[model samples]
Structures are given as C-alpha cells and as structure tokens.
Target chain A: MITVRCFATVREILGCETRTLPPSSTPQLASDILRIVAGARTTDLPKPLLVAINCEHASLTSPVKDGDEIAFFPPVSGG
Target chain B: MIIRLQTADFDPEREAQALDVKGAGARVSFVGTVRDTAQDRRIEALEIEHYPEMTRAELARIGTAAQTTHDLLEVLIIHRYGRLQSHERIVLVTVWSAHRAGAFAGCQAIVDALKTRAPFWKKEISPEGAVWVPGQTPQDLR
Candidate 1:
C-alpha cells in the first residue's frame, strides 16, 4: 500500500491526515492520488499543491511505489 | 556549517557566541520572530508543522547552496516548531565570510531559501480562530 500524507490546509480541507491506498498494477503518479484527495475534499482541485515523495520535493509526474510516503500541502511559509 | 531544528526557544546571544568568530572579517545574523498581528488580525501564537527528515534535508541543501553561491566561511541555521507565542523567535540564520558583501548576500539567500524550500506549515491563532497562514511562492514572499 502507498501511504499518503496531507498537511496544513489540505488536511483541513479533506478532514484527514493520512490515507493508505492500495497499490495498483498500473503505475500511480503523485497527481493520481492528489486527484482522489481533491475529490474527497469536495473541491475542484483547489490550488496547486506542493508534493514530496518520502520527504523530498517532487512534481505531480513523480511515480509512487508501495510503502512510499507521499505528502501534499500548500507552498511553504517559513524562514 | 550547522543546522538545528528544535521546539525550544533559543538564546540568540548564546548561539552567536558559540560560533567561531576568528578569521572572519564579517558576520551577519538574522532572527525571525512571530509578529503580533498579520492581515490586521491579532495573532496570539503560531502552531508549526514540519516533516522531520525533509526539514533536515532541505535545510542542509539551503546551507550548501548559500555557501557555494556566496562563498562563505561558515553558516548556521536554527528553526523552531510547535506552539509558539507572538514575539518569540522562530528562526535564526548566521553567515560568516571574509567580506561583508558575501556575508550579507549569503545570509539573504539562506533566509529566502528556507522560506520556500523548508517543508513547514504554520497556523495563526487569534481571537477569531486558528487559521492557516496563506502559502505563496518564494517570489511572492518579497
């Protein structure tokens, strides 16, 4: 299973912090899971989300594998 | 170079004194504090979230980038997370180099990089309610 993590606004929007999705025979990209979250949130894919695969910056086109931790959130606001 | 991510508030003076000061012609230190207000609303505190491994990775990357881009002698970074009150220091960045220009430029780069690259989310707490700080790109920060 691939674990998905959401933070900040995305977590609040979905009312969930984590969701484990069953790995599919076909390769799953980060955007695919993001689509699911947006659907669950009852929103039309709000704004662009910043993605990280296993804690590293990744794009929507990045691939996902079983046991991988994918996090989605808004752009950073830190210093 | 040094990097520290902690929830405990740090003493900037103590940290500054701990660094090697000899052989450096210039030093620049920056401390970021939580403002009491944002968007005309009073902010009582901020709750911060971060990805542990990711925070370390990105901070290291920013440190290295600042060093190479600005040619610095030393670099230091400290960031705090968790519930924190207004006026509390949120981060500390220090840069040392043979010249003031490099120190200034390197420190700026390090700060800017941290704001955008670091995987940290903050929420603003006030009388109204706790609200997530709106996110923006690095360019928009300025």
Candidate 2:
C-alpha cells in the first residue's frame, strides 16, 4: 500500500490529510498521484500543480514502491 | 537532524544554534523570505501549503543527499506554513561543513533542491486574483 498526502489548496479542497491507495492504482507515479488528487478536488484539475515523492520532485513516470509516501501541492512562491 | 513545518515565526539565531556540531568548521545558512512583488504584481500576502509526512520525508532525503554529495557535518531545515506577509522568512536552511565551500555549496544545493523537489506550493494573493506560480523545472527539481 501507498500513502497519499494532499497539502495547501489541494488539502483544503480535498478535505482530507491523507489517503491510502492499494499498491496498484491508476497514475502510479507521484506526478500521476497529483493529477488524481487534483481531479478529485476541483472540477477541472489545474495544469501547474507540483508533485513530490519522499520530498523529492518526481515525474509522472517515476515508479512508486509499496509503503512509499506521496505529496501533492500547487506552485510555490516562497523565497 | 531537525526538520520542522510550522506556521509560527522562526528565529534564525536559534536555528543556527541548533547547527552546532563538534567537527564542523563552518556553517552556512539560507533563509527564504516572502517577497512583496511577484511577476510585477503588487503583492499582499502569501499562502504556503505543504504535505505533512511527505514534506518531512522529502526534506530528510534532500538533507541526506546533500550530506552525501558534500563534506557536510550537519544540516537543519525549517519551513513555515499558513498565511504569511511580505518579507517574512518562509524557510531556513543551515549546513555545517569542514570548510566554507562545502557549507556554501551544500546549503545552496539544499535550497535549490527544496524549491524544485519538496511538496510545497505557494499562491500569491493580489488585487487581481490568486494565481499559482510555476515550480522548478523537472531538471531543476532534481
């Protein structure tokens, strides 16, 4: 199993802190997870949201192993 | 070995104090503050968002990577969440190394990695509307 975390606007929009998905899920990579979460939160998923796995930015094809942690967030403006 | 995600204000001195290690000769620090203007828009405030578990893990991983790449002794990273006004310190990074170059390089790498890697996002609230800024590119994220 993998733990999915939503943050910032994504968290507020989703109304949950974390969600657990089976090892085999759609959009398996961390980026894909963001897409799924974004889709679930807003009627139309924003194109610019960011995704990270284990604190490192990951592409949509980055494979996620079992017990891996994933986080999804929008763009950042902090210095 | 300290990682924090808080909405409360942070003290760089205190954060620096935490980086005290026996073997390190130099300590380099980086503070990320909230800027007033973004994309030429008169800024008001910033809303910072991050994933909890994933953020911590990602930061730790980045710290580890920095340690591996550079001859660093210790590292400290602090990131704030929630509403923040302009000029507020949003993130703090401290690195201890045997030499200044290592510390500086490690610190820079950490901050750069954080920008592109960490699951943190920011939204600028201005007179016009709220817009999400594009994050680091995939190459930059790495």
What tens-digit string does per-residue lDDT give for candidate 1 at B21-74?
667999899999999999999999999998778889889988998999998989
Q: What is the lDDT of residue B139 in candidate 1?
A: 50
Q: Name the regions of candidate 1 deviating beyond 4 angstroms.
A: A42-46, B138-142
Candidate 2 lDDT over residue span A1-79, tens digit each: 7888766666777776789877764436665555555564555433465566666666556778788877666654333
Cα deviation of B76 in candidate 1 (Å)?
A: 1.0
Error of 2 at B30 (Å): 0.9
User: Scoring each candidate complex against the real one, what DockQ results?
Assistant: 0.61, 0.38
Candidate 2 lDDT, B13-92, residue by residue in tens? 88798555988889988988887998799778888776666678878988999998998888889899888888888999
Ten residues in a row with the worst lDDT in model 2 chain A?
Answer: A40-49
TM-score for each of the candidates: 0.90, 0.76
- Residue pairs in candidate 2 whose N, alpha carbon or C atoms collide under 3 angstroms: A54-B58, A55-B58, A75-B122, A76-B122
What TM-score quantifies how close candidate 2 is to the native fold?
A: 0.76
